[model samples]
Target: DSIRVGDSLTSADRPVSEPISTPPLAPPTLSCLFGANNGPLVGQEGSIVTSSKIRARLISETDNNVTLTVESCIEDAEKTLVFGRGELQLGILIEQMRREGYEIIISPPAVVTNICPDTGKKTEPYEEVVVDVDAEYSGSVIDSLTGARKGVLVEMMDDASDGKTRLLFEIPSRGLLGFHSDIATVTRGTAVVHHCYLDDREYAGALGSKLERGKLVSCELGKATLFALASIAERGTLFVEPGDMVYPGMIIGEYNKVTGGDLEVNPVRAKATTNIRTVLKEEKAYLPPPKRLTVEELIGYMNDDEIIEVTPKSVRLRKVELDSGARERAARVKKKRLQAQMQKKK
Candidate 1:
């Protein structure tokens, strides 16, 4: 196959035009970390996993699992670096890792910012979002996105073929972080959402989290009882139903927005019975359906001080420190540190 029959082989030191600018070596725009409570991954200490678009190095083997980092880098083609790109890919990676008998506490994904070379301004990657929903639900979707997510509406059109409304917008990649479930809730699970990277733009300016509510954590470990769930349901929504296993520091539900701040409660309290008979009959209690979260939704729902515990058998959400006293102390310290930083910025 080598240059047969005097056919001249076109060879050069380099390409004349550099071939489509080589895609400009995509910038690292997203990140996640190990939980603050994890220690050495059992025996896999000092191990690292990397791929074409992501790199996770076991930065520390210390028992206190804090100070973790991520970098999107192109490496071996066979490795999957897709964890930072698509939620489906991320879910797949977690599933695969858990099935391999590897369990770890992973934090929620956060967006990484960069300085725009031209304007010398802080910039973060933007995403082009397309949402198709029933015409009746379009208003709710738009209100949710524009309210606190800082999304800019680009176009709104109605699909002639399906009678659904197509809403397009440009939103910060960070804004899309855990918005899938919210959209589903608003649209009654009739919405289809998709996003793709556009380009970096001037910082959208920090915005309050649309998901600013706190979580309902368990105070004890045991199988949830209907009596305990009834009490929990009164506070807000319940994530676990009767008979589900729960542990201390594990998130059992989202606290009511009105009654904000993380609240610890018992999820396994047994119903009390007495020999005394009351004249009035106790009413039969109907338990509401538990709000089940998929892996992607769980990631979106996790707080910075929280992590998702992955295992082949279960996926659980828990605070960094399993001990309530330690977790509160850590939260206070983090709060104070953040306040100090904010003061310095001011």
Candidate 2:
């Protein structure tokens, strides 16, 4: 219907709007790499291949578990190929797939690597990173990129107005896993970063984990109590408030640097009602705000044995094996492997 210059549509004349607005279709992510979904599939393990641009290859399947290598597509850096893309994407995809009647498990994002046939050397993905930061924070950016992230300085210019500095680096894609949130912290939230794939390069040496100290893991599943948090406050920084929900194996806080190993304590422990005097004594105690890490920061916090569980309702940092016993077993196995390697080096 055509409207005259000043004409207004009445309620009856207007088109009916649905209660929930339809969300726009999502643009493809930078790139996606899927692995570590070792769970049984209900349907014939073949639909995801035909319905979308995702590429999947069945690694193994049995009555109990199905493993697949799923790759996501996106325009490459040169805009020449859609061969690369995901940690958050994978988690969200798996959650959506489950909602859509599929059974799957997916791991966090990781750098995909290939071997150079001629040299028989391992090569990993690299990225072209462009960072714009305040002149004062430029040094921190440069140090972080060039030293910790295995980045090579491409260029640095202070030509921009407003005391801004521009930095360019070619860094391993893996090095960027948790850099987004960290740069902000280092620069006091004064840095702007942009990055994309830059072909595979020679393998960088082993990089260290992001966590400087061990984490505070919740031993019991329940809402966190203030008394419990007060008890744990001296242990390390809490990542949850007094009333937040926590589950077994979920990380609730950081551990003291001096005592560095995952410490399991009950966040959900209730204060005994008989201790009113003690409560009053402890009530005035200052509780530092817990850290609110994003999915990327949580990714940084991950050890090889942990996973960040993301869903529509919540993002929970959890051990890969929820069972405490299983995690300990895995840790012991890892320690033995490390010891054996050290012996070999000796």
User: What lDDT is obtained when candidate 1 is compared to the true structure?
Assistant: 0.70
Tens-digit per-residue lDDT, 5-91, candidate 2 = 333345776655643344432222233323322211113332332222222222111111212233333432211111224344444
Model 1: CA > 4 A from native:
1-28, 34-83, 160-162, 209-211, 257-259, 271-286, 334-346
Model 1, 1-346: lDDT tens digits are: 2322323344487545433332233444456554222422222321222222122323221112212223333442232222255455456556655665555557677687788788899988888899999888999999888778889899999977878999999988888767898898888899999888788888888776554777899989789998888878888888888888888888888888753788999989997889999899886667899887778888777877887776555677877777989987887998899999999999
In candidate 2, stretches whose alpha carbon ends up further than 4 angstroms from where it belongs are 1-106, 208-211, 275-286
lDDT of 1 at 123: 88
RMSD of each: 8.4, 12.7
